[model samples]
Every structure is written in structure tokens, then in C-alpha cells.
Target chain A: MSTPKKILVHVDGTERSITAAQYAICLASFYHADLTALYVINTRAMEDLLKARIFLKDEQMEYEHDMEADAERYLNYVDELAVKKGLSITKKSSRGSVHKEIIDLVKADDIDLLVIGELSRIRSRRDEFYDEAERAMRTVPCSVLVVKDEDKVWEMYESLV
Target chain B: MSLIDLVVEDIVKIPMTSNDKPDVLRELVQTLKDAGQIDDFDAVLQAVQEREDKLSTGLENGIAVPHGKTAAVTRLKLAIGIAPNGIDFDAMDKNPSKLFFLLVAPPDQSGPHVEALAEIAKLGQSRAFCKALVNADDAKEVVDLMKGE
Candidate 1:
């Protein structure tokens, strides 16, 4: 029954991310806690270039730029959703490994709880690149909520509306 | 509500090659036709394009659910295609999509169409699902993985 202060929600502009955002917003509203939505850009394109994939260099740059722009557009949507729900929310974007950035933010912001979608790539029980959230859960000094893919929240929404 | 609502068969290709969005989409639609899932390829493509013009179905995690509810389709169906190399989809993430869940629902079933899109979005958000999709070698594997097997 400790008071909640700040909560961080990781969003990757995926539908699962949106659902996670929706749930986070609800939690923020209930606790009157500040919500921060984050999007992480994968640096694998740069890694691909370093691997000597010469033909992909230009395409890789274009892809990176597009991803940044797309992240901005999606953050705008999250911002709007926060406004509509009367939740105090801020959105931030970063580049690099998703788990590292998320962990850094948790410590820097002193986050009370971290919420993210539990899916295939990010839910690795083991593995460096894929099981980012699981890795963070073990190391970070905060509670983690991995939203299930088949959670009944949407079903409830559909039924209520 | 038969499980085989969509007959992808040999039409599903992995590591599909396409320089851009239109070409990839056209190829996927043609695959559906070749698999005998749809009667008219051109009409279905047009419908999908027109829908894209209105709103992108890219939900996240390098995934795009480019769907069309068209009269060209007699039944509700879905076709999944994986582009391991990723295709430019003008998605919100600007990441070329390695996974696509192309849905073709009857124009009349608006509710299910939206539901399907949401469901696909939910599936894409799961990092595990996206990883499996990127690694899947063929259509049957893709279908089986999507069905949670």
C-alpha cells in the first residue's frame, strides 16, 4: 500500500505497446502518478553497416531517419491520449539497445514501476539481444509488470463499449 | 469460423524481396490469388491501396497490418508475409517491416475487421512473437506460430 510516485511505460509504436500505454494511463490516473512513455530505437542498422553490408548503407540511413520520424509521430499520439485521459504524461525517445536505455531511465527517474508488453523477442528467459525486459527485471531496482498478450483488458473494453 | 479461413499454402514467402511498399504489397496480394484465396488480384490490391491512403495499419515492432475490407473478398481471410530484409512501409517506427499480417475481410464485417487489426497489433507488440515471425522459414510455420503453437 505504498504510494506510487512515477511510472515508466515502454512503447515501441506496436499495437501491444498501445495496449500497454492504455493500461499504464489507467494506472497513472488511479495513482495520480506521473507517467513517462518511452520508445527505443534499435541500433542494429549501424551494426549491419559495420558488418560490411555495403549495399545496405544508404538504405540503412534512410531507414534510421524514417524510424526517428515515426517515433516522433507515435509519441504525439501518446501525448494526445494522455491529454484526453487527464493523465500527466511525458514521452521520450532514445537510440541504442532497448533494455539498456530502459534500465538507465528507471534508475535516473527513480521510477516506482515499469510496464512493458511481454511478447516473443523481448520476453527472453535468456539471451542478450532479445530478453531485454527479463534481464532488466532481474537487475533494475523497480517493480516490473509484463502485460500478457492475451490479457482481458481489450475484451473488457469491447464488452463495456 | 473455420480455422483455414485463409488458404496461404505455398504462397507464403520468407525473406521476401521488395524495394518498397507497393511492390511488397502487390506481391503479397498476388500470392493470395495464386493460393486460390481470392478471386481478383488487381481489385484486392486496389482496395488495399485505397485503404492505406486513408490510414496506415502499421501498429509497431517493425510490423505492418496492411488490410483491406473489400467486396473483392467473399470471405474473411488473413495472409501473413515475412520480409526478413524488411520493406519500407511508411510505418510510425520508420523501421522497414519484417513482418506483415495482411487481412482481407468482407466489407460488411466491420467489427471483426477492426478486432482483427487490434489483435494483430497486440500480437506484434509481443517481442517474442516478432522474433519468431522474423525467424519463421515458411507459411505453415508462420500460421502455426500465430496460432500460439
Candidate 2:
């Protein structure tokens, strides 16, 4: 296989996912590759939250606004990091199941590499969400890099922290 | 290192009053400094802020693991803090953060660092475990819960 020219990073705004983004940015910088950072919102979870909003309609709106603001903050952070590192990057935000969104983005953007944070190695059948993400990995067309907690790459980011 | 390698003591504060991410981090860093677990509190704060400039540490389920690897630390350590008021760590869930696991590791240990992060991610995803952390009133309670007691 040839070297990947573009990378798609899956960031959930979690510490782990953000860390994964950091790594992707660094790699992009090294390879002089283009990067697309994506945030996937679980629509099902949002629907559930909306369904439970019996007592406070305003509160739910406030909650959603807050979430969007947070996502923006995180995306901006990544943008700044890329700028500082001299890496080219594009950011995208979507609301849907994480796996499907990631797959779609891969096909739409011609992404050569897909990066994601590892959830857990030990998951029961009850961990349906992670199970779905893991299953999606099998069908993804590009090279996949799962940033596990046990990987040494985190130390590189840790140094900058 | 395993998440089990990290220990929580009497530092967990249930019902923390701060509702913002900066304030929560401020409080937690201060607590660690006061407890003498860390020296040069300002350095740690700067490191965290610099890291936050790159990305948020907020995870799912109202948990934020704000961490940094710094030269000020001699070894890897973990501090657990709980805020019942749910500080905004800018979690992906858009939910306010109630539990914080502040990680500090030396700049040299590369492999253990990632393992430590992975361990935290594993623990953070466990709803039951996070609930136990939110309910913890003191450091020992937090430690015991992380220990799966």
C-alpha cells in the first residue's frame, strides 16, 4: 500500500478522544498530510434526553446549546493546535450514531486513515455502544489506528500538557 | 500502568460547588498541592491549561480526566475529585462533569502513560463505577470504589 495522504480523526471530546486527535495532528504534521477532525453525536442518546425533558423544555435547549458550545471549543482547540504545529486540518461536527457517521465521512472524504480512541478491551455484551463501534472497524475501508490507553504515544502528548 | 495502579484517597469531594471546568480544575489542582502530592502547583496548572489548549479531557458519563505529563513530577500519580454540582468539562455528552481523575506522570515513562490513560478510559465507561465515584464523600471512599470494593 502507498502512504496515506489524508486522515480522518474521530473525536468525541472525551479526554481519550482528544488525546487521539492530538496524536493525529502530530502525525499529520510529520507526514504533511491533510486531516479532518470529526465529532459524532449519538442521536439516540439525544432523543432519549429529549424524551425525558418533561419538566423543563428550556432546560433541554440550554443543555443542547451547552453541548454545542463545548464541541466548538474542542474543535477550535484542535484547530489551534494544528496551526501551531504547521499541520493542515478541517473540522466537521455531525449528529448521529458514531460508527455510521465515521464510515460515511471516510467514504465522502476519501480518507486514507481512520483514527479513534480505544474504549475498553474488556467489554461485556451489555456494552452495546462500544460493541457497535468495534464491529464497524471490521468494515471500514481505510487503515485504522486505535489509540489504546496502553500505547506509549500518549506520553508524547502528555509532555506538551 | 493499570488504572488499578492509580489510587484515590480522602480527596474526593462529593457535591463540589464549582460548575465550570476551569474552576473545577483550579480546585482539584489546589487540593493536590495542599495534600503535598505535588510540588510546584503553578507548573501543573500551566501544563493542564496548555494541554486544554490542544483538546478537552472530558469523557462520556460526566467524567473528565484532566491530565498532563510534566517534568515537575518524579513519578506517575492520580488524584480523584468529585463535584456533585457537575462542573462543565466540555464533555462530549454535553453533560456537566461530576467526577475528575487528574493524572500526573513523569515525562519519561512512555508506555505506562498510555496504559494509564487507557485504564482511566476503561473505568470512566463503567456507569456503576462512575456512580460510585460521584457518591463518594471522602478520599478513601473514592479509592475503595476505584479499587472495586
Candidate 3:
């Protein structure tokens, strides 16, 4: 309800996540709020590899290193966008459940508002529609804004020329 | 890159006349050609259409960002179109898309293209900003809103 003082955007490699980061930057600029972009590496996926013994010991280490690099790369891209706008943003990365990390970060940073993209990869399952977003929305302490691209009236003008 | 800087003034159509996606894209692609942003309008259109064929750029709420990486543009080019009545864009949310951000860039210029796309995506999230853009009656008003003036 009140002007947000601290805003966090969940950033991943997806286009939708990039949209969320952009929305967060705008909201942070308008409200003069501190902005942070958080990227989680999905440690659970790595754990699955461990359980399956897919990679040998040395290979596992290499895989983890590559994944870490990817996380930093994504975070840096977000940082670049913030810098271009003449605004500074904090970039954070974690390794664990995506929604849990976000929820924890919200509490740890005293985040007042959380911005996220509306759609994510759909899984082929009985409850295909429910995704991490549903969980994050239900549990996060701060106000959550799921940024969705909307149709505006202005896009319709046809060129007479 | 600032979305405002990339906006071709002559092409920022408000209440864009085309109701369907392909025509709207054609109109915008022509805008780029008229502004001299792209050399071959048909190539750029094909590229953008190809991108869309992969997946609908129709994002939820009301925005569609149709983009392509092609040789037609030497640098990054952006055109904004708004349709007050909304058109069926086959968006992920299945809602009619009213605001369009047409991004065209050379295949090598992924950096600028991504930056501008991110900037537009962020700007699109603001209900207040979108409202102001919708109420804007002319190109100047639209440009001013993007400039954050």
C-alpha cells in the first residue's frame, strides 16, 4: 500500500524473468527504492546429479563451477541494465530451492516488495499449471507484484502513408 | 541503451490502426524502413515473423515484444505501437495485446538488443506508465513518458 522502500526482482535466464527485472528497475526508480536482483542456481538439480552419480567426482566439481559462472553472468546482465539507467542495484545469487531462496532473501533484506515474471516453464504433470510462483506468492512476507505485459490502447494506429 | 533513444519518432504510432498481428508488424517494419533504420523491410519482417513463429511474443497484461536478429538492420532499431482496442496476439496469457515493441537488430548486436528489450519489459510492468502511454494523444507525449519527464 505504502511506497515501497526496498524492492527485489527474481532474475533467471528466461525472458519473463528479464521482464520482471526491468519492472523492478522502473518501480525502484519511481519510488526511489533500493533494488536487488537475485538469481538462484537450483542446487536441487545438482543434487539430483549427485544421487544419480552421473558425473565423476572431478566432473561434478567442474559442473558446479560452470553453473556458478552462469549465475554470475545472469546477475551481471541485470547489473548492466541498472547501470545504464544511472541507477545502482545489488546482485545476489544462491544455490537451493528457487522459491525458498527468494522468500529467505525477502526476510533477510527487509524487502517491502517483490517483483516477478508471471509465466515460467510448464511441466508435464497432472497439476501442470501450479509452479514455483504459486508457492512464492502464497508465502513471501512482502507485497508481491507479478509483472505481466498488458495491451495498451496506443499500439493500434495504422500508418496512412 | 535507453528505450527513448532508440524510439524512431516517425514510427511511434499511437492507436496503431492495424488490428491483427501480421499487419501491425508490417506497419512497424515499414516505419523502420521509412526512418532508414533498416535497409530491407521484407527481410526484417521475415526475421521478426520467424521469431514469432517460434513463440508468441505476446506477453501477459497487454504487451507484445516481437523481435528479430537479422542483417537488415545494421544497428538496433525499435518501434513502438499502441492499439487502444487490443488485438488477438495469441499471447501466453491468451489476452489481446495492445502495446507492441518491435525490436530489430543485426544478429551480432545481441547486447544492445537484449538491453533494450529488458528496458522495455521493465517499462511495460508499470500500470501507471502504461496508463500514461495509453492516454498520450500524440508521439511527443509518448516520447516524453519514455524520457521519464
Candidate 1 is graded, for docking, as: incorrect
- All candidates in order of lDDT, best leading: 3, 2, 1
TM-score winner: 1
TM-score of chain A of 1: 0.82
* Model 1 residue pairs with clashes: A14-B60, A70-B92, A119-B126, A119-B128, A120-B127, A120-B128, A120-B129, A121-B127, A121-B128
lDDT of 1 by residue, B7-101 (tens): 34555667677778898788779778877888988888987887677656554577777776578876666777788887888877677788877
Q: Write the per-residue lDDT of candidate 2 for residues A1-161, one digit (tens) a residue.
A: 46778998876555666777888886786677889998655543444433432113443444345446655777788888777666668989886655788889999999999987675544333332233346557678888988765356656654442
Give one digit per residue, the lDDT tens place, for model 2 in B1-149. Answer: 24454464644555566767888777777877877778888888886776665567776788887776688877666767788667778876788888887877655432234345545665666888688778777777776666555
Clash totals in order: 9, 11, 28
lDDT of 3 by residue, B88-114 (tens): 888878888888889887654443344
lDDT of 1 by residue, A1-161 (tens): 78678999887655566777777777787778999998776554244322322113443454456557657876787787777766568889898766788899999999989987655442212222224445566777899887765357555333331
> Model 1, B41: alpha-carbon shift in Å?
7.3
CA lDDT, candidate 1, residue A95: 82
Error of 1 at B135 (Å): 16
Candidate 2, which CAPRI tier?
incorrect
